[model samples]
Target: MRIKLENGKQNELISLAKRNLTWKELAEKLNVSEYYLRTDLFYEKRLLNSEIFTKLSKIIESDFSKFIKLKLEDNWGQKSGGKKSSGRLKKVLKPEKSEELAELIGIILGD
Candidate 1:
């Protein structure tokens, strides 16, 4: 099933998932590369396939239907800016003192 998520709902889901599971664990559960989850899904705002959405819903222990907006149509325009931006991922400096700060940085980098 093709679906469009409500605005910022994907990021919200990712935050919820991170609270309960590490990136590695979530990647394994979704059977996708961690890079893809971090880069494509989180950063690029790619739409989720039905299988992955179902797994993510289960992993986050929430009903996903409320977050879904519409069944995506073939000609559905990009909800993000129409053109893809070109750039390299910025280097993140390691956090010195707090692990929580580090994790938050990681989450932002993923976006």
Candidate 2:
């Protein structure tokens, strides 16, 4: 499915393989509330804000536009009028750099 974004761009939710991240997981990763995340998904037509989106892009090993496109595709492209689920596995923010930064900070702080 595809939907138009605020940028007037069309995006598709090809499959969970595209993002593999859930809305709740993405909220936690962005340090934002799920409500805020869902609001963005529905109203703002985006999953993460610009800054957070950049971080998320790295985390999920995908481009930021992919997230926006996926959200649009997921929420808006449904003609079935039934609930949609991403199957079993969920995708969350998993940036290698974020983990590295955490480890580096722990080492520096002697934690």
Off by over 4 Å in 1: 73-111
lDDT of each: 0.76, 0.51
Candidate 1 residue 99 C-alpha distance from true site, Å: 73
* lDDT at residue 102 of model 1 (Cα atoms): 76
Return the TM-score for each candidate structure. 0.59, 0.34
Model 1, residue 108: distance off in Å is: 52
lDDT of 1 by residue, 17-107 (tens): 7686778888998899998898778753687777887887887789878878877754455543344443645889965779888788799
lDDT of 1: 0.76
Best by TM-score: 1
Which candidate should be chosen as best, given lDDT against the real structure? 1
Looking at candidate 1, the ten consecutive residues that score lowest on lDDT are: 79-88
Worst 10 residues of 2 by lDDT: 8-17
